[model samples]
Target: MSSNIRIIRICQQCGNEFEARKTTSKTCSDNCAKKAYKARQRSTNVQTSAEQTLQIKLKPIEDIKAQEFLTVNESAMLIRISRRSLYRLNERGELPFVKLNRRTVIRRSDIDRLFDRPAELMEKSRPEPVALADCYTMKEIREKYDISEKALYELIHRHEIPKQYSSIYAYVPKYRIDQLLSNPSNLS
Candidate 1:
């Protein structure tokens, strides 16, 4: 029995028919290939134009609703912090909020106001730094504190310390460490 299977070809542009050496071939000639390419480009242009029109029509509705009251999670997302951190801020009288029944609500205007304030405002609002001679390395902190990296991470994760995201890991502020060291009661 013969092993070769028959192949079919269809012109992509003018719909002319011909035989092909392989099943994957779609055009009868280079002219048909160029024509098919042009047709594809035209379809892409039409799609992009339609999408732009739709976006233009919808943008005003989105803009008008942008300042609506936000949920705690939404406020957290907007501020790039966790919900727990936001709650902490609220508890500390740092973040303005409204208590709606059992739920906490924040206004978009308030969030914008919070962010619009200068960096000095936040610095002034934060707890005063404790005097410490040396900055502790992660290894030193782990060993001296008798805590694992995971435990240290837990403090940062819970927002007990001011932390910044480094390229590979989170770095705790030195003052936070000092505060923890100063408070013997916090050891557990």
Candidate 2:
């Protein structure tokens, strides 16, 4: 019978030098091998997590099919308007829509009709332009200046900007807005 020869090796997990009975022994003990296996599994999980994150970041937009209806949020995103505005328009019955199993959806054709009006039809429906002396509402001013409601109110209270009562709502004079734009120092 041939004599068994032992091999000297270093443990891959614990970094300890030991005599291995088998040539394929990677760790000094079973405990070290289990720990090494767990570490490898943890590293694999981390790599998969990073890969999933990258996939989400590079995800493509879904294609819109013909004759497909869209949800309120989807319609809002497509039309570049806020969800609240879309909801308001739907509630006012200005936009054609349908309810399906408690979900409200607008037809793609209806949205297309809103923007795809004929030039003659649009000209016929357009209202007359307002005079320059007409004051603008606080909402209009906020949108025009891109300022917060609080800031606009503060400016109005400080007398830096002037406003007039229009029966129901207070309106800021257009001349004051023009003055502010002409002299930017008045904003502070």
Candidate 3:
């Protein structure tokens, strides 16, 4: 369509003002039009990338289950965590993967197997903490072992022995205390 109507319009890309012959004209000149077209293409490309990323994050595992092999990026997106975390798991020898070029692919089956042995991750049923009655008071540990309070405390700290503190006395497990302080000659 041709028109004699001249309208001042702002270029979408450069924001320059110029007279346009047609109402549909968005840019001032051929250069501005090219720039605007390129800008629009870039915007669409960005939007597409963002949409793909969201889709990857939101996609269900069932949808991806058919695939046997996945790249680090795909596996990370599938697991809904960062690639760094997956890499850490690999470093810790918890998550197994096939290295094709130093770092290549992870098996979907390996991931499934990792989750299958959930017991590895589950906390073992804690045996209830021994009652203070079953444990010797810290004073008793010091006196029985013929050690000073400071030495006894240092030993406990160094050995990472479990102990409980009450209002007046700290209690050490009987077995732990006996194991450390018991004399074999005395037993014999």
Most accurate candidate by TM-score = 3
Local distance difference test, per candidate? 0.66, 0.70, 0.73
Per-residue lDDT value at 102 in model 2 = 85
Model 1: worst 10 consecutive residues (lDDT sum): 162-171
lDDT of each residue in 36-148, candidate 2, tens digit only: 99999999999999998787445432544343798776677677799877864553334756879989889988887777888898777543444435777888877777767
lDDT of 1 by residue, 1-188 (tens): 44366666677777878766656778877788788899999999999999987875455534534857877866776666898888766644456677799777888887777678799987876755433333455666777777667556555445545433335443456666767755654444
Candidate number that wins on TM-score, 1 or 3: 3
Regions more than 4 Å wrong, model 1: 1-65, 129-188
Candidate 3 structure, TM-score to reference? 0.48
List candidate 2 stretches off by more than 4 Å.
Answer: 62-188
Clashes of each: 0, 0, 0
Q: For residues 112-178, could you state the per-residue lDDT of candidate 3 as single tens digits?
A: 7767765734334223478888899877776777777756765665555655657756677888879
Residue pairs with backbone atoms closer than 3 Å in model 1 (clashes): none
Indicate the residue-level lDDT of 68 in model 2: 74
Per-residue lDDT of 173 in model 3: 84
